[model samples]
Target: MRTALDVHISEVGPRDGLQSVKATMPTADKCRWIDALAAAGLREIEVGSFVPAKLLPQMADVAAVVRHALTLTVSHPGLRVMALVPNRRGAWAALTAGVHKLTLPVSASEAHSLANVRKTSAQMVEELRSVVALRNEVAPGVPVEVGLSTAFGCTLQGAVAEDDVIRLALACVEAGVDEVGLSDTTGMAHPAQVRRLFTRLRAELGSHAGAAHMHNTRGLGLANCLAAFDAGVRSFDSSLGGLGGCPYAPGASGNVVTEDLVFMFEAMGVSTGIDLQQLFAAREPLKAGLPGEPVYGMTPEAGLPRGWRA
Candidate 1:
């Protein structure tokens, strides 16, 4: 359990980061990267998504990656492996592979929901119910987390209604999901909106409210994360080197950079259980995994503030 002063950074680079890029990371390299991330003290990681190989070749080897991540848990007892699932089938496959948690993305915007998953928000809630039921039968101990993407806004639709987001979140919770997370999928979220929505979510879902998945598209990723933290959100999802973007939303930037976010928290005297130097060192395996791919991070480029200590 994390205290109020303790912030949990869930690394989504391997899963969310790789999916956006064209090149497919070798299965062995993916495992090495994940191991490096764990060694750097990232206790929770989204290793991969269980989508079809035909639809996303980048995640075709997700099962193999999950097996490797499970093995890492043997050495790193505090490590928690998480995978993304699109539906009940994916959820079953992820559970069989022994992930500690499964995150199902439910779009708050109806247009984005249809475009991304070919289902409406209401239909996604029904799917969540079925997925939860399947989890109860197969892996009763495994948790299911629903990420309400486009909760702030969507590209397909101009503005997503806050009422709609709240209602959909309530519906997902009623459908028996263990937790509900908010995602700025299109990178249109502002700090004030992040704080407001998170406060409302916590009020309605209580402890079941999950992580904040913010994007750096508009350069407010860190600011929005701080707003969410102020509103009682302890868990945050970010990518190493800022390597992720939504395929459904055109022109959206990658997720918030993990190294920068860690620096922000550690500088503010918040403990993330992650070492700055080791965390930056983990970027080596990531670069090796995806040769020629561009990775972004202010902390890595600026070499940490002068005379700074973590």
Candidate 2:
């Protein structure tokens, strides 16, 4: 929320990263990692998801973790605690946990939608409307957004049409969501596609256009992000150490790396309001929590440029 920051980065490591991994970080470790991230100046973080404990045991303690994260707002004022909800039940739980924001994943690819959420694309939009209604009744102040997953392409169905992505976004808007972000869930996005789709997204949705959730699956994460920026996107979703991938999307891997992303913008003289040194230090808790887990980042490996300051 800093006025000086040119772009908004929402850290999704806790939810997206942890869920895709084999280990369940202890609740205390999760809190510590989150604290480190907040200290590093990440204003918004998707702390966890609301799903059946049997389905994702890693997120079984999500409610408790959300409460712990809420306490951080005292020190990190303006920090927005966010959660991912797959359905109306999940939305209700997230609202009850006092989350500042709720993001629902509605896949643009019908095959991906059915596989991930057990619902068709149309059914998922209806689900979103129900979630929005619940939010209005109980937590009207909370913002509800949709991450239109597989907007770029899908491994299951392959090459999702652009029209589907735009249609689903407008449908979510009509369902009362505040914003709809395009997600490259399969990491199949290229710079030109990213530019064209995001430009069309901004034109159609206007102020309702949201974050660019690019994956580094094909090594185009940074380039796609730069393209999104060129197309007028100001918000992005990344993970510390590039730790996330879709469980249902086969062959998809790695969320955009936070360290590399902040470094990229800062090196270009774009203010991210995030200190690079502290951001690197934040990776310590992550390593401790998920030991031996590969956390990728060019900036962390090479160190900052000589005499560099952010």
Model 1: colliding residue pairs: 244-254
119 Cα displacement, candidate 2 (Å): 0.3
Cα RMSD for candidates in order = 1.1, 0.8
lDDT (Cα, tens digit) per residue for candidate 1, span 169-276: 999999999999999998999999999999999999998899999999999999999999999999999999999988888777899999999999999988999888
Point to the candidate with the largest TM-score. Answer: 2
The runs of at least 3 residues in candidate 1 whose Cα sits more than 4 Å from the true structure, single-residue gaps closed, are 1-5
Please report, in order, the local distance difference test score of every candidate based on alpha carbons: 0.93, 0.95
What is the Å distance of residue 69 in model 1 from its true position? 0.7
Q: How close is candidate 1 to the true structure, as a TM-score?
A: 0.98
- Give the poorly placed runs of model 2, Cα more than 4 Å off: none
Under the 3 Å rule for N, CA and C atoms, how many clashes does model 1 have? 1
Say which candidate scores most in lDDT. Answer: 2
